[model samples]
Target: MDSMIKTGIIELEEMEFYAYHGCFREENVVGNRFLVNISIRTDMTRPMQTDNINDALNYVQVYNLVRTEMQQTSNLLEHVTARVMDSLCRHFPDIEWLRVKISKMNPPMGGQMRNVSVTLER
Candidate 1:
């Protein structure tokens, strides 16, 4: 006999913030808008059977982790993105996979680009 474990994905998209994360002095001082998207994959077997909050990944805590990291300024989106992933790993051992996207809106790169973003997965 074989048993299969149930898995589920939780996504948080378009979470906006006003953060200072860039190399330019103006960007660091003035701050800019950022959008974060996170997709977390984990086993949901316990949550499914128990129907208890403790058995599932608490999104409020996840959001707090994101907010805490976002508040700290970074020179590169990649660095901040990595920090976010690291935080998730520290908090949630059940996460089997993660995808994180950090977007800086209206980056001052001397161009008409709307945004620049970095996506990381593991």
Candidate 2:
């Protein structure tokens, strides 16, 4: 018999917020709907065996961190996404990999685009 370590991914998807993040002044003032998604990869061996929240990555804490980052105004989606990734990595030292996506809905680009999004992975 052999013991194997398992890798697990915990994903938080489509978390929505109304934030003032944009290049335009009107966008900063009026704000817009935004969606955030995060995926974190970590060792799942302990959590799988013990079935304990403490042994696993806490999603509530993840969400709070993402929310805090989103609340800070930024002009670029890339910057926001990077901030989220940085914050997550800082808070969770055990993370093997992380992916973050930020989408701005109905952007003021003078076109009929649904949304503009930025993604960062590390």
Candidate 3:
């Protein structure tokens, strides 16, 4: 068996966005902050040698896609994550696999705690 190349971790933190996504009525109307982190597995065999941007995955475009998707309204974080994964796979065919984590900060819960996040893969 041959070992595949890894592109390491790519993270985007504190990406604040206002989206109407939640089960509660106020959540949809009021909206909240969201943070997204994406990890992509790319075949770096060529880029390592050529040192070309096109040879490897373009992460900036991927981040843009995630940002655009997060702007839309959705009922659940799972749905948003799935959409992100699908979009990423469609845009970047070189990616063998991807992990997307969507976080909803300061959820309507009455407790003082960190945000809620959902991770999905494709």
Candidate 4:
């Protein structure tokens, strides 16, 4: 038997923070805005009826993990995105796959906005 469930998109925008994640000295001290988007895939067959939070992946807990990751310092967006994915996978073993994206808005670049992100599956 095959069972799969689609958990709709969960997005967190304009999550401002101060972090030393840039190569430049000035950029490290002056942080920028970070946006995170996470998509979680799991089997909802059991949780659908039981209505037990433990039976399924808790989105609230996922959000908190992202927040906690942002608090840490990473010099690369890829690292940030990977950390988010790893954290989520560890927290919710029921999840079969996860897609995580992290964007750094309004970067130190002189011209247009700076946005970098990565997607990972586990």
CA deviation > 4 Å runs, candidate 4? 1-18
Residue 26 error, candidate 4, Å: 2.0
Write the candidate numbers in order of decreasing lDDT. Answer: 1, 2, 3, 4
Task: Please provide TM-scores, in order, for all candidate models, with all chains considered together.
Answer: 0.93, 0.95, 0.85, 0.79
CA lDDT of 108 in candidate 2? Answer: 95
Candidate 4 lands at a TM-score of 0.79
Candidate 2: residue 8 Cα off by (Å): 1.3
* Stretches of candidate 1 exceeding 4 Å from the true structure: 1-5
Worst 10 residues of 3 by lDDT: 1-10
Error of 3 at 9 (Å): 5.1
Comparing 1 and 2 on lDDT, the stronger one: 1
Residue clash pairs of candidate 1: none
Per-residue alpha-carbon lDDT of candidate 4 for residues 35-57, written as tens digits (9 for 90 to 100): 78777767677667677977766
Relative to the true structure, how large is the alpha-carbon lDDT of every model? Answer: 0.93, 0.92, 0.81, 0.72
Tens digits of per-residue lDDT, candidate 3, 11-101, equal 5555667687898999989998888888877767677778899786787898789888988889899999899899998998878778888
Q: What is the lDDT of residue 24 in candidate 3?
A: 93
lDDT of 4 at 111: 81
Instruction: For model 3, give the RMSD to the true fold.
Output: 3.2
Q: Number of clashes in model 4?
A: 0
lDDT of 1 by residue, 62-110 (tens): 9999999999999999999999999998999889999999999998988
Quote the positional error of residue 17 for candidate 4 in Å.
5.1
